[model samples]
Target: MTASFEGLSTSAALELLSVGELTPTGRLTEASNATLYCTVAAPGGAEAGCVYKPVAGERPLWDFPEGTLAGRELSAFAVSDALGWDVVPPTVHRDGPFGEGMVQLWIDGDTGVDLVDLARDTRHAGLRRMAVLDAVINNSDRKVGHLLPTPSGHLYGCDHGVSFAEDYKLRTVLWQWQGEPLTGEALEGLAQLEERLRDPDSPVAAELRRHLTGPEGYAVLRRVRLLLHHRVHPYPSPDWPAVPWPPV
Candidate 1:
């Protein structure tokens, strides 16, 4: 049987998400954990232009034993929002007659280059900016596959389930910019984040303590300081797990 959100029944949501009624628009690429489709459904029948990510079946590389990938996706959005970053937000989570799935606002952009490609291209100055954001947020799984570019030259990021690791899992495709100087604006953001992270009552601080080990949590803070003060590049790791095929 397909999994579903705790309270919201999937059967009730399927009356709206059926492919025939809601017209799938684009055949975005598929990953190991989920299949992404551009669709017209507004999640809860609210608006159009939404991206549907359906998590079904097991894939080879998913390491999290907790049955909460959907929840993790939602949490990532929350963290991004808290830090004043733009991210796709979930519309609804349900599992019913249609299957277990999530709907989010579709981010329109050209296929993003992997961190490897971005590192090689000096023209992608925006990538350095992204590096600081990723580090501050403790994003661990930032592969080339997660960054999406738009025809209009805007870049958007996705697939942040393994972020905020609190561990030293700063693995990514963009390690080339490690040790580069951060812009003044980036430093300001890091300073604000450090203050928030250290606050015992802060939501982000509470989250880190709950989800991460003491060393892991400390590492996140240390990396932020390094990014802000030392211009330390992220330590490189070659054996990092590949972005799971068919991203969940």
Candidate 2:
């Protein structure tokens, strides 16, 4: 079992992660920003399997100005939690030899299906459902790589740094579902979301409003409501970036 992040020395954190001693069983992916591997420990163990997303010192194409990358990730997790969506929860944040990084619960599953594959697969109802959620939240970076599919047939999304926009960036691969009819359940969710946005007392709504101007906030709310009420909007084009490249 691996030691907790709190107890790990900077050298130990770097060593364990680099040597694959922490997540002993799985192989790390080459494309991963922070090292990603599966832990050998059982799900509930202190050293249980989890994914580590250490903050990268390299400047990214899009960066957040209000906070550190880790802070933005933590904030997004909080927002998703408040909105009742499942998201990767932060387990620990610590300084390691490499720099600042976070440990999060590992989501054991297959690499998410590519958007092209999902579109080709006729039996993807869950993907369809996710499209609605993506649209509602204005998730701008729903790239093919972000949606994981578990063995049990559930789809989970990740990498939402570009969502909520503070502006209105709704770019995503789920655009195929554009103009599809909204079900009663979807409509109800939107109605609830609208009410929440209208309520100044709600923390999420307040936070969103704080980042966006009154008109911008209303535009977002109205746009979402319109999508729910009318089923779809025009598919976004490359000419106009619906969302900023890096929505900090």
Candidate 3:
């Protein structure tokens, strides 16, 4: 079921993503990992656009186990949704061209907006929410290009394959807010995230456990606790790369 992805509400698009039949449409040439574009179709014949990343195509990392990146992507979406940020377009794990993989509802982002500029600008509310997400996930790669701004004025983030590591590895272009106190809203978001993570049976926690290792999932709550205790944005770690290469 391949049709236009235009004009769908976020909730509607997400619901379709969970149950729609996937049909490969094209390949995204820019992705370093194996990334494919597809159309999702419901039994009723409606369709929408989505991106697919299969585990078989994921590159092995020295630190992370092989074939786990797809799950991290799903985990990131679960965390974002749990926080009610909706910063990550709805994503789910399922069978794909190669094997088990992730399929995310595609966002028709406004490419004209300068992500680098917005990532460095503290006044943008969307950017702030993304920063918090990165911190919570321990995102190791938050490249400027990963920040997608849609025409509907919402900012979505993608490429969360390197997140939720048990160690500190946050590297992003959003360090502009570093050293500043967390806004009241940010603190509240953290509190809510902490609550969700504390319950092993919660939907968000269960979903995350399916994707992340025990240590990695625990790290998420630990990071939330750290953020709440500090009540401020964290500084870049000098031991690791503080920003993604190419920066955009």
- Number of the predicted model whose TM-score against the real structure is largest: 3
Q: Which 10 residues in a row give candidate 2 its minimum summed lDDT? A: 1-10
lDDT of 2 by residue, 1-248 (tens): 11223454333433443444344344456432545555524233334355655567424535234334444444344344444444333334555445665454455556544545864453476666566666655666766666666665656666654455444567766655555566665566566667777777886576555444455456657766677667654367555565334322
TM-score of each: 0.62, 0.61, 0.93
| Candidate with best lDDT | 3
What TM-score number comes out for model 1? 0.62
lDDT of 1 by residue, 1-248 (tens): 12122232334333334431344565465654654565554444533455555556324334454444554454455444445444333344545223665555555555543545554564464566566667765666776667766565555577765665544555556666665666665676668778877887886677556545566567767777777677554555456643332331
What is the Cα root-mean-square deviation between model 1 and the actual structure? Answer: 8.4
In Å, residue 125's CA in model 3 sits off its true spot by 0.4
lDDT for every model?
0.55, 0.52, 0.85
Clashing pairs in 3: none
In candidate 3, position 131 carries an lDDT of: 95
